[model samples]
Target chain A: MNNWFKILLLSGLSFFTLGKAQEKVTIGEKQNVFSKVLNENREIWIHLPKTYNDKEINPAKYPVIYLLDGEINFEYYTGLSDFIARTPYADIPECIVVGIKNTERTRDLTPTKSQKKSPVNPEVTLFADSGGGENFVKFLQEELKPFINKNYRTQDYSILVGHSFGGLFAINTFLMHPDYFNAYVANDPSLWWDNEVSITRTKEYLEKNKKFPAHKMLYVSQADNEEKQKNWNSDMTQAIEKFKGIVEKNGSLNYKHTFFPGEVHGTVSYPGNYEALKFIFKGFRTDIKQLAKNPGLLEEDYKQFSKKMGTEFFPSESYLNIVLKFMKSNDFKEPETYFMNLKNKLYPKVK
Target chain B: MNNWFKILLLSGLSFFTLGKAQEKVTIGEKQNVFSKVLNENREIWIHLPKTYNDKEINPAKYPVIYLLDGEINFEYYTGLSDFIARTPYADIPECIVVGIKNTERTRDLTPTKSQKKSPVNPEVTLFADSGGGENFVKFLQEELKPFINKNYRTQDYSILVGHSFGGLFAINTFLMHPDYFNAYVANDPSLWWDNEVSITRTKEYLEKNKKFPAHKMLYVSQADNEEKQKNWNSDMTQAIEKFKGIVEKNGSLNYKHTFFPGEVHGTVSYPGNYEALKFIFKGFRTDIKQLAKNPGLLEEDYKQFSKKMGTEFFPSESYLNIVLKFMKSNDFKEPETYFMNLKNKLYPKVK
Candidate 1:
């Protein structure tokens, strides 16, 4: 390490002559909606998918997912969603994500007030102003959903996502307001509040209702370590497990339960979120090879999906564009005429 | 859905007047370093860690990790690293990441040119210009490393990270230019390239050398389904498995291997990069409770790291600031006096 050489290394570095792509970075834009129900101004972070941005004209409208804990988990959820949408396997259709930020963590997310001790420590009591969940639900329905529906290009299909205390909020929303969203994803929710009052509510709901809505889905993940490894009893994991068994036994709702064996409560969210996304969109992948193999199968698949969704799923132009792309890249000859014929049939309505 | 209510949701759909902490999102800065070795300009994306921006004066110098495949994976790596560094359980020390963008990805990343067909399809041959990996390593050593080391507050302790062909590039650089980086992280490297040429080379090198340097660490991850579930034998996972077994058997070098089940090749990079970071920095998290238990332990831990890094890792001021923060947050009474005594001992050097 010669001093002069090190100094030379330190200075006069040359730059590129070629024009560089402009450095562009965006998480999402901040959106604030005044809530007449909660009587406060609320904030949300909204991220539209890349595919939506790709076509300036005739852009596709996407389903929306409302996420809780926006201030902390917004970046992670958006990043993961964007990645999943772009990837080939389990190709998630682009979805608009509205990440709702917290005004008060304990005040809003919890379904009930509790003077009970923290599950981990009996000495430390849970937050005092803890029963604002019903009001929060009112705010989302009356203020945010209507605003998003009026402003954005949306299919009116929706999902709700949350973690920890936020997860508790998600389950409460699902139980009380079932028609609000098509799916709910909860990760390691703190169900131990007020001696597992939320869990008890869940049990009562399951026992009363013979069947949940057929189209709606619920995904709940309990972290492996919190109860067993961290303590013996009375934790979030235990309450979640109890709720899971009851919900699973009811067998009426389209429910998924993921138990992450090696992951703890802290690290569980990342994998939990990823796994939950996969579970929610179980068949949401496009196999190019499989599509190329049988053109008729692709047509039938979308028809079946359309019937299930109660919306016409004639995605002719985009499907044609993809077919052309594959034809160029993979030298696929048969799919070109298949898409062209499909497009002709689909375009008559547009014409 | 009343017309007047819809108009209200739209009209009052304004942003928050409530003071937001400001949504801050940074991908990285665009950097172009002219490579005299390759006679071309190379572009890179560099993300400085949280600690770098924490202070205006006496900014902290971090160990840099140079990541290959910047254009695609840069955002993922930076996002994940930022998340891990901030989290409580796996509190990775602030690290500067330099993501190297590709001009000709196949040309630069592959060590040997392949005339053979794609592993999946024997009809279609692999890329023609693929033997430039040695020259690419030269460009990194002579040009990019010097530029990053010169411009940034870097400790000269470096890590090289890559995935797919980029992962192959990382392993080749490790085998050939071992002294260039302190650590290497490869995620499902395409070691199947040139009929497992890199794998053969890795095996040869291990056989020749009795022991690798103690300071260097290597982390390799392979997606579970690629070789076994997707196809058999002649896949990326097989080469990686072969290499992993050999490296782990030698047991002289610091090494880690992660097998991600049910994850395909395309998506493994996200969790793989995350798992690799956790493995590389095992027991790297800072626990306030652990620190409170023994006041002398933090000093000793940094001392050990410093010795291992061959540079003084007494992260003095930042470490102190965090300790003060924890003491305030957790109401630790003893660490206050502990910090005062430690400051008296360490601050004279700073003064």
Candidate 2:
């Protein structure tokens, strides 16, 4: 090859390599095994926190956040989690986010079958294939759960977040299997589903069931929509208010609902998720030393608080800090013995 | 080739194309031009806002945030911007960020020559060749500026953001070319540069110059550092305070200096940028009618605000809303004569 041509080729090659080096790491080649359980191929994005791979830090387990519409909402949730985890005010424990992508979104998310025309494409044939919430829950419980447990170091705490159609699925799952998740976030659920069958079912369920599991539920609605003819947001607002009323009347339910006046449907999900996390972890204080006297005392208090709030029992950063402070405060004496005994009981047979 | 082999090759080719079709748009790309002046000869990353390239609406010009040490910090800034832009309380605008990758970071960012030995490789004597801020500024001003202007629809309001060593260079550039950028955000600047020569020079410059141009400057420092033994932050703070005192004694000057109580150097930049932008654009409300009436209003307001704050200005969504509200309110007026006359005064030759 000519010298000039060789140099030019080398420069081009260098530039190409430089570009490759600068490119952000996109989705990896690993196929999500969870997709196979749904009997469909779809992408799943998993974000392991910064501390996930550290060998020095043993007994590392993170609370998991399962997000629906993984392809669209995964980035937003992952980013929010990362931001909050790093901040001083909301120094939430590092979380493992499992972004579950959709194969047949309409099939899996819809709670009941209804004959309705498509809004985006009106020309499409008017046919509805819905009511797949049970199978979707089965996929999450039987297939996805085992896969995540096997692969990741996860704590008992778990949150299920969804929006619109996915929100319908989330609420259905919460009502059907209350023990599965610790927290549920439904951002503008299509409560208008099949003339409010889910809401009606919820009312019946609340009346019959005496004891509802402790879990945090945040239901959010947007300000304006032409769908509510009388007042722009009144229909959705009323639906949410009525749903909250049912939960409240049950006396053993925990829920929080918010109405964002200016936010549209598309934009509500991001802020809703952030606000939900903030509200769920609102009581958690970073100053853990305050509870140093008795770790069990702190846990007992948290448990009772969770029961009162109708939320799943989980120890936040403050709770963990209190444990650490108690252990270290007394020159690592009886507190250390207690922790050692607790650890031994938790992980029996481990040396 | 054999028939089976040929079929396999064709199938592979088709799959490759399919994969490409399915791939989501990643953050960074090779040789993607941001502006006419800022063409990517080397590897560079550009973050386009969500509304970018929306043809249905008139193209919105975004404030450009340029990050130093793009190779290391590009992903972080991109992630930070994405998170902040989506948050409810955070009014920071959705920005088009240009992450300028470094060729020789030490050569470019440093403002003065260094004879200090390399700590990492002390066996081999190291002569630090520094003081390249002037040439670096020229490259940014002449080459990158034109490239960005030509390719992207950008607001005249631009932010120069940097950390540590890069932070020093940002301050140096702002002092030298006050009119080049609207705001200068320096996160923990190396004010102790070459035994505080730069700081000394800054003092001298302030003493000599009577009229300082209108611009915003934010100097952030971390709590704990060995170099800050003599209360470095306070010293630096006092120096800037004294400099400001001099400027204020002479006339009015815009400046803001803050110190993070417990945050270290590495973790200060993101939060610093967030707070700085908030502080800089604290009360800046945009008037859309004013922008329409006087097209130069956006540029003028940005300049005036930055000058008032003494830091680079970043307008948030609220600021845009104010402008939009102004435009909406004024556009309904029956007589368009006032608007036309104002436009003529602003741009005499255009009409």
Top lDDT model: 1
* Segments of candidate 1 deviating more than 4 angstroms: A1-22, A116-126, A227-234, A302-320, A343-351, B1-24, B56-58, B118-124, B225-233, B301-322, B340-351
Worst 10 residues of 2 chain B by lDDT: B14-23
Write model 2 residue lDDT over A150-209, tens digit each, in one string. 667887778888888888788888888877887888888877777788799887776787
My TM-score estimates for the predictions, one after another, are: 0.87, 0.55
User: Candidate 1, what DockQ?
Assistant: 0.26
Interface RMSD over true interface Cα atoms for each candidate: 8.2, 11.3
Q: After superposition, which runs of candidate 2 have C-alpha atoms over 4 Å from their true positions?
A: A1-23, A26-37, A55-59, A87-90, A117-127, A215-234, A248-254, A282-351, B1-26, B29-63, B67-96, B99-351
For A212-298, candidate 1 gives per-residue lDDT tens digits of 777788888877865334543237767888888888888887788888876666667777888877876655555565666676776
Superposition error at A281 for model 1 (Å) = 0.8
Note the Cα lDDT for every prediction shown.
0.73, 0.61
Candidate 2 docking classification: incorrect
DockQ of each: 0.26, 0.09
